[model samples]
Target: MIFDKLKKFDIVFDSPEMDCPPVFSSGDVVSGKVVLELSAESKVESLKLHAEGFAKVHWTESRSAGSSTAYTQNYSDEVEYLNRREVLLQADNGELTVLSAGRHEYPFSFQLPEETLVTSFEGKHGSIRYWVKVKLHRPWATVKKIKKEFTVIEPIDINTPSLLAPQAGTKEKMARTWYRSCGQVSITAKIDRKGYTPGEVIPVFAEFDNSTSRSVVPKAYITQTQTFIARGTMKQKRAVVATLCGDIVGGNRRETWHGRAIKIPPVGPSILQCRIIKVEYMLRVCVDVPGTSKLSLEFPLVMGTIPLHPFGSRTSSVSSQYSVNIEWLRMAIPEQPEPPPDYSSVVSEEEAVQNSTEVQPEEDLSGVLQRSLMAYVQEFRLRPPPVYSEVDPNPQPFAMRPRCMTC
Candidate 1:
């Protein structure tokens, strides 16, 4: 049985054997079974063990100072993108056992903090590292420790400094912009039809250069503020060239706001307001800004509107195609609603009544008065009129006629 005396013990890891997920987002438990297999010819006093988890972040920034002819350089960490440390687990002496001869497997498991698993790692630079280490304590000069790179990833914790005022003085202040596209934005707009059939929705679309330092949150509006004479009836439609009520489609924010940062990364080259309702005879995009001047966007705006539909139904029935370019320049008009039109000047009740009576010809005085009474009759429409196109004479003219003419 001297072979039993040759038995010695060793520890091994399984979860992060090669590479591990730094933070296991799954609420499910993360565990590892440590197999304590004994050698055939080894004797062991006791197996004392512990597992420790660690995480860290790191980054570097380089700067250059220049002179008239030459420039010196310096290097340091970018303070804006700094790193932090977090302890994942510490299972100290969690497992200890006196060994019996031959080979055996011991399974060990541990639970990480609930909040730590779901905690965010946005916007932070450096690397997130994790691993499990086991130690074998003995009656010797040193304790053996085994370490491995279980997981590595960039932390998601990104943050920007808060400010009370807009950063306007210098580029350095505006450096808060995370990502900037060095390309130009292009825009092209068009209407679906060349001419409009009155009261019809005109489809408009804008294709533009999406390259920008900021993400585009685009809106559209239309207005009939300008008038073009119509061949038929003059019913015009107007809208604000830009409106924020539409949906955001085709693009995303360059950086997500994790609620921890004051400003988010810029995003752009997006397409918005593609719905039919957002379409109009003319269309324009109005960019909204938080701190930066929205006007800075070089607006080569493309505008077109749908043609009016033929006048028959309250709803537009015929659709004609129309296209026209509109120029949008800043104006100083009072931004208040235009006062309601002066109804007193446009129409009067007495004129309306006089026009109605004269338009219908009647043959007799009784017939002339009957038209007025029939207009108010509830069931008159269903019943046929007693007579049509009857003529009427003025009472004054009848009075002036001689007795012979009357006879």
Candidate 2:
């Protein structure tokens, strides 16, 4: 039988000269060879190949229908980044081609599309994937098919002006009881920079104050947010990627973190070049109290393929003319791990802290905290027009010459 004669069929990629795992990016040429080994002769009509890259998101959420009945809502969307096809071998006029071969190799190459592509990622509800497939057609036998997947990485440097800027936020929440208030909880947190690569350490400094009757614990988390949009609606999923916990603070006590370290785990680079689906990261510092809702301060984070340059290497903010190192482009983008651990697992009694001050009304408190989150970032849209006194502070009392009568 043909199965006995056909020993092996496989595809292999050509290694780069640099030997850094032969990573690929947009507009790259991917060259590889298909190896076929057989002990006897074989006949085939054609061998063809197909390559494609795409991102897709799908998930179902449950909602109430009645007291016990529930209905499901599905959200799904997809984007195609590349598609290409090739014919490796074929009979000139659809005739079966005979091959008496012990070892055969068919080389192939593909030019990835120049369009922007999101890095390879695997998440709970979606994934960005790239792959190539091959088919071998025979006259009177079943067609043989094989597939292989590849990684696509888009470099993101951390030395840019926005990413290099420090991030900080402050939020306060009241600790209330049924009859009276138990004081308040507040948290102020800051990070040195926003952009980072996998395995890099984030330096988090924060102050936590607890005036509530209940003990408070301080915890930090690196979270991944996956957003999927369809039919004018959106669904989101958040997973905890990394976590840090601090000791408990009793009532009327405070705790300070001096550069508390949180190391980032292996994760895919940010996906900003795609539509319909977005992958984002953030740092959440929370103070867990005994009875009330946990108070949290959130700061956005950017995950990138390239690390920040060494200290003193960058004299100023990254300019448009700035270029990334070639070595970084050659490194493979990390594959995002399948759904991280649950967020509830990180909560512990010994790891809560809260800092609070007298603040009335929820909306006003949120506005004040958001306004105080970053001194450097200004959102004029969220802020009303500047308040000015009716009378000018410095009156420009220049005596204009009386010219109305003469004109």
**Candidate number with greatest TM-score:** 2
Query: Roughly what TM-score does model 1 have, to 2 decimal places?
Result: 0.27
lDDT of each: 0.27, 0.65
Candidate 1 local lDDT, 1-407, one digit each (tens): 32234343343444433442232332334455444444533333243344333322232334455654554332212111112222222335644334555666555545444333211111122112334555544333255444443321111210111211111110111212435333333333332222222222323233323344544544333321211111221211122322222233233222111111010001000111211011122233333332332312112211212212244222222334321101100111122233212212212344324423221111221221122111000000011111211122332232243322201
Against the true structure, what is every candidate's RMSD? Answer: 32.5, 14.4
For candidate 1, the clash count comes to 52
Model 2 stretches with alpha carbons more than 4 Å out: 1-4, 17-21, 60-75, 289-291, 312-341, 345-407
Model 1 misplaced regions, further than 4 Å: 1-23, 40-55, 60-101, 116-125, 148-206, 209-407
Which digits, one per residue and each the tens of the lDDT, describe model 2 over residues 1-407? 55667789887888754443455788899999887888889887888989988888787778898899999988788888888999998978988888786988999998887866677765555667788898888777788889988767766777788887777778888887785688988887788777876656676667788888778889898876556666666655545767788789889987777557676755446777677667778888998655567678888898876566655122222223223233233222234434333644433323222211211111211121122111111001111212323233443322232212111
What is candidate 1's local distance difference test score?
A: 0.27
In terms of lDDT, which candidate is strongest? Answer: 2
